[model samples]
Target: MSEAHEARISRNEEDIQDIWKVVEDIKKVLAARPPLWCTFLLMALSSGLTGFIVRAFS
Candidate 1:
């Protein structure tokens, strides 16, 4: 293969590796956070309360 083509391929590989590293770092950060169930539970409770209030007032 031509030298320029080989160089481009090498750079592309490095770029791909860099992207994977960023993705792995992001995965680690997200894994360290608490689960989302609490948020969902709060949302559900709020919606239920709002619905109850609306119904009672109507």
Candidate 2:
């Protein structure tokens, strides 16, 4: 194989490894966070606000 072609392939492999390391680090950080029940609270608040706006405009 030509030297330039081999160099290009080596650089590509290094880039893929760097990308995987970044993904693994993000996964670890997300796994360490505690789960919360905030979605339901937000949904209820949004629904109430929509109803209020509709009633005020009617």
Candidate 3:
């Protein structure tokens, strides 16, 4: 193959590898985060508890 064609193929391979690395990093971040339901549950529980305390003080 011509040198130019070979160079293009090499660049394409490097770009593809970079894309895959980004996808993997994103997956790791998502896995580490808490699920939406868990976060919502915590917020609801805290709000309810605070409301209860305020009501008692009144």
Candidate 4:
């Protein structure tokens, strides 16, 4: 492949790695902060929506 293609692929890989690191940092922050009732409420809502979508399509 060309140098330009290789450079772009390298940049894409670096960007993905940076994003994953940010996600891990956010998880650590959340774990330390430990949101109270609101987090549980949101989690329940997310699970309910997921179940609803699965049942609807299935």
Candidate 5:
């Protein structure tokens, strides 16, 4: 193949490798205790507000 075609292929490969590295890092991060804590906090707050609204309506 031509030089330009080879360079383009190399660049595409680099981009794909970089993306995979980023995705792996994100998986590691999310495997830690972050999403669980955030999800629990959101659910607790929503349920608290729902209870208050139910009491107010009743």
Candidate 6:
């Protein structure tokens, strides 16, 4: 291949790698949220139950 062609391929490869890293970082952030939501949901349910019990006891 010509030198220009090789240079273009290398640049394209670097761009792809950079994009892949960004995608991976985004994936990591996305993957880390479900458990947090589950915890929040559990806390909300517990608080609601406590409120219900208090009202019932009153």
TM-score per prediction, in order, is 0.59, 0.58, 0.59, 0.60, 0.59, 0.57
lDDT of 5 by residue, 1-58 (tens): 9999999999999999999999999778777878786798799999999999999999
What is the lDDT of every predicted structure here?
0.89, 0.85, 0.90, 0.91, 0.93, 0.92
In angstroms, the error of model 5 at 21 is 0.5
Top candidate when judged by TM-score against the true structure = 4
Against the correct fold, how does model 1 do in TM-score? 0.59
- How do the residues 1-58 of candidate 3 rate in per-residue lDDT, one tens digit apiece? 9999999999999999999999999778767875965687789999999999999998
lDDT at 21 for candidate 4?
100
Better of 1 and 2 by TM-score: 1
- Candidate 5 has its poorest 10 consecutive residues by lDDT at 29-38
Error of 3 at 14 (Å): 0.2
- Tell me the tens digit of each residue's lDDT in model 6 across 1-58: 9999999999999999999999998778768897887788799999999999999999
* Cα lDDT tens digits for candidate 2, 1-58: 9999999999999999999999998777666753433555578899999999999999
lDDT of 4 by residue, 1-58 (tens): 9999999999999999999999999788777777765688799999999999999999
User: Per-residue CA lDDT of candidate 1, range 7-40, in tens?
Assistant: 9999999999999999999788667763675576
Model 6 whole-model lDDT (C-alpha atoms): 0.92
In candidate 1, where is summed lDDT lowest over 10 consecutive residues? 29-38
- In candidate 4, which residue ranges exceed 4 Å CA deviation? 36-58
Candidate 2 Cα deviation (angstroms), residue 29: 0.6
Model 1: residues >4 Å from true position, as ranges? Answer: 34-58
